[model samples]
Target: MNIGVIKETKTDETRVALQPFQVKVLIANGHKIYVENNAGVLAGFPDDEYVVNGAEIKDKKYILDKCKLILKIKAPLDNEYNDYTKDHIIFTYLHFDENILPDKIRELIKSGFMGIAYEWVEESGRYPLLEPMSKLTGYLFAQKAVEFCTKYKGIICGKHEDYLKGANVLIIGLGTIGLSSLKFCMDNNLKISVLDKNLATVNIRINERFKTNKIDYIEKYSIELISFNNSDPLKTKAELEKTINKYDIILNCAVRRPDMPKDKLEYLIDRQMIQTMEPYSVICDTTACDNDLIETCVSSEEVDKIDIINDVVHYSCDHLPSIVGKSATELLTSQTFPFILEIANKGISEAVKSNKALYRGVVCYKNKITHRYIAEKKGFQFYKLSDLV
Candidate 1:
């Protein structure tokens, strides 16, 4: 098996798909590893390190032409589209749900490569590959929230007793990203409240995680839990209007379903709701898109670029993990290496047939769209991998 690690071409994307250590392991397992020249440089793993670890350091063109399997941090850019063939297997964060454009999706299908999206690969109802980066993104978002509030709002976020007045933070959703943000807010002694669709379940999880015997700090802390119903936007909006103005910061980590109808989608926080927020208050949307949970959030800004809407600071950088390249690459590659090794050893056909998680990750295989959600969302014909194989 011949595998190639390509340099990420996305703007501000610094993470590499495979680390030097992983390259060494793959080579030891009777697999040939070819890393693009300087592929891991931005992530602190130099080409020399890969060469030392038994990986051939070659240019992108040479590696793409030679290797059948391609490992990447991001999907192939427009310029690299022509280089792919039906024989290639691209394993990366394809982001067909949102980040990727229609033309790119079309190109991917036309190219007939087996496209395995890292974010879609799941095990035990968890996205194993996506979780690490999600956690990292949440941690970075919390740090950015603090920085944005202090810089733009001119106030420190801390406990009221130690400071003049504490900042109130409202975290939307209770997923990995939201919980990570909540932990950071709790450590900073900010008045924290949580909003989720199922408040009771969230309460149970929170209580279980912060048991009195385990954690003393959160034992006495009483967090207000708010319920949100996405189906009833008007009701949710009315309920939020009552207290939306009180929070100094709002972190939206809730994800919108990719197959959701555009007409049916409603903003969780509209312009009017944002208007109620105090001047200079910050809203950070971790799950950022064009029509995100936060109406003002657009994924166009570069890392750390703040947008001001109605005097409220909005921080929504889609690739927050990319900013912390070294940590992200190390965490991401560790999880993805095992899957890569499986494919390398067993071949794509055998690997996908044997591993359900790997099969679920395949969005496009055998010149057809294999993922139902992606197929429906993109209006493409969907085919089962079993049928295709």
Candidate 2:
């Protein structure tokens, strides 16, 4: 099997799918690995490292044309569509439901090349590939808040009592990213509040926290929970606006996929709601998707200027982990290498047919949508891979 790694062309993306160490592993398993020139450069892995690890450094054109399995950190950009063919098996974070994705990618998905999203691959009700990245993303949200707070207010973000004595943090959603953010605050003794749509989840997570050593010393008043659900967007928006003005830093961990209807999509912190936040407050969006929960969100590429929407700083970088490229690339490679191996060794059809986790990752195959979410959202005829296989 010939496996290829390509340099990510997405704006501000720095992580690479295959690390040099992983390249060596695949090569040792009798698979030929072709990496695009400088594919791992930005992620702190040089061309020499890959060459030393037995990877052939090839050009983008050759890899796309000849490789059987294509690995990428992001989905194919608009310009790369023509480079792909029906024979290619692309594995990456194909956020297909992202409203801002190029139209051609949608067309390509329906064209029958197998597309596997690392985030969508599930086993035993857990997203194995997405978990590591999600935890890192959540932890980094706290670091971003610190960076932006120092930039805007001349106040350094730190855990020491005197450094950021009055900084208040609000985290929306109690998922992986949200809990990680809470962990940061607890470790630093920062004043933090959490909001979740699931009240039962909030109760369970909070009760479990009492048994942990992380939040024991923090003042009970400093750490608070604001409970609400997705039953009513308008009500949630109103609720957010009411307390938004109190926080100095906001980390939105809410996740919204493309298949959701306009009304059903959770926009807890819309533009109107954001206007109520205090001036100079930062909103760090971990799930940086199009038409985000934070309506005024911008991608990392477009975040150069101070986007003062209603005087609040809107910072939404889709690939936050990429900013810390080395750690992210290593973690991503660790999680995804096994799946890549399965596809490389068994072939796409056989792997998906035998492995339920890999099958869950398949969004398209055989000129049809295999994933129910994408098929139903796009109003296309859905075909279960089990039936087709």
Candidate 3:
């Protein structure tokens, strides 16, 4: 079976779909790989590298239409691609941002080529190939969030010649992204405060990996408890109020809530309780895309409100894990390449027979929607790819 690598035409996208070293892995497995010219330039892979690795630099046509599998980091632009048939498999990061599905994603699904989203693999929690990038986004957000909080709040965290020191960072979840952020924060010697609804589950799954707070946000930091999934926001006008100065940066890596619960927002902004800080106190809510989260954050209502006091979000932030381009590509590549190589060697049939990486549409073979959020968007029926298998 032929595997194709296409140019990543997305504007300002520095990472390539396939790096030179990765192509050689496929070739070593006796698979044919066709790459578009200069596909890996930005990632530091020269044209000579691909040639040495035995991948053919070919025109887009044979690589797209003829190959049984297509690998890319971006969604295929509809106008540039050939017909998408049921037999084809396109593996990519299918970003879902808004209520309105982007034309690129709608077209990919309409193209009807068995679409496998690395991002959605986590939605099922069975095969989590995409966690590394999720980890990447979370880690970077934590580091940058500290800067946003200090600068906004008017607190000086580090010296000109030194790295950030003794920052107070709050990580809301314990997933890979959350864990990565926590680790990054600790490595920088920042004070960390962890909050979560479920102590049991978080401890069981994340504690061992994170070393059970061995990283220590406590000696120099403060901790708080809150529930998000099962209970309504606590009307703790006072308990939460006490938590005010205890924290400097709140880095939310949890699920998005476009607008947060009204009570939650009220707790955040009560002037006498919080506005007393040096003024750069900030909340870098990655969950801002969620209507529940955005609608709830008082910061969005008045970016100046915090800026006036000194807390500000210094850099533009997003769920676009791609911004940490080279790191994202390398981590995502190392984590996902093994499965692609398996599929290449055995073909989809034997490849997926026992392998969890195989997914058809949104459904797992178990007959469940791997991504309920995406299904909710377009009213598309989800079948379990596992059951079908």
Candidate 4:
């Protein structure tokens, strides 16, 4: 099997999909790896490192033309669409739900190429590929909150450094991102109120994990639990408004609304909702893409900075993990390398057939949409990979 590692071309994207060590492992396993020159340089892996590890550093054309598996940190950019074909396998963070599916994705699907989206790859009902980045995002979420909150004099009234103490924080989800943010909040002595539809499930899971000593953060942080009817957003909004004004910062880590027409924006935190927040309050969205969570947050690409709308500060940068490039690359590679190995060893068709986790990650295969959510969203013909296999 021949694997290729390409440099990320997205703005501010510094992480590489495969590190030098991972490349070495593949080479030792009798798999040939072609790494683009300077692909890992941004992540602290020099060309010499890959050479020493027995990876061949090649030009972009050679890698895209020859490799069986194309590894990447982010989804391929629009210009790179021509590089893929039916014969190539793309394994990356294909965030279809992050926003409307681009024409490039449609093209790949139409071209009958295989795409394995890391975020959709689940094991035991948990997103294995997304977990590492989620944890990193949470850490960055806290940092961004602190930076913006202090700079704008949003949360703390007194000394900037002491603002975290007793500051009120509202976290919307109880998933990995929410949990990670809670940990950082606890460390800063912030008062936390968690709102989740599955409040009972969260309580039970946290208590069980804490009792079993499974999570250090749970044991350390004391949280106030708030339950709301997730299905009823208006009711939830009303219930939240009663206390939302008191929170200094609102961190939305919940799943985003499905992609819709660009003209019609469905927001989790809309303009009317932010009106309740105190002046200069911060809204940090870890699941940042469009205005799905933070209504005022112009696509970070459009504004290139925080937007002050309705007197509340909004930050929604999609690629948060890339800020810590080297660490993120290492974490990403460690978690995803096994799946890559499985596909390389068994081949795409056989790997999907044999590995349930890998099969769940397959978004598109052989011109068929295998992911139910994506298919439903895009109006594509749905066929379960399991059934097809």
RMSD of each: 2.3, 3.0, 5.9, 3.6
What tens digits encode model 3's per-residue C-alpha lDDT throughout 234-258? Answer: 4533454567566677666666343
**Best TM-score goes to which candidate?**
1
Each prediction's whole-model lDDT (CA)? 0.84, 0.78, 0.59, 0.79
lDDT of 2 by residue, 135-250 (tens): 88888878778677778866655557654465788888878888788777766666788777675456456546445544333355456767765556667667778888888888
Q: Which 10-residue span in candidate 3 carries the lowest summed lDDT?
A: 298-307
Supply every candidate's count of residue pairs whose N, Cα or C atoms clash at under 3 angstroms.
Answer: 0, 1, 46, 0
Per-model TM values vs. the true structure? 0.93, 0.89, 0.73, 0.88
Regions of candidate 1 where Cα sits further than 4 Å from its true position? 207-219, 258-265
Identify the candidate with maximal lDDT: 1
- Candidate 4: residue 85 Cα off by (Å): 1.1
After the best TM-score superposition of candidate 4, give how far the Cα of residue 75 lies from its true spot, in angstroms.
0.8
What pairs collide in candidate 2? 97-258
- Which tens-of-lDDT digit does each residue in 309-344 have in candidate 4? 788888877888888889999998899999998888
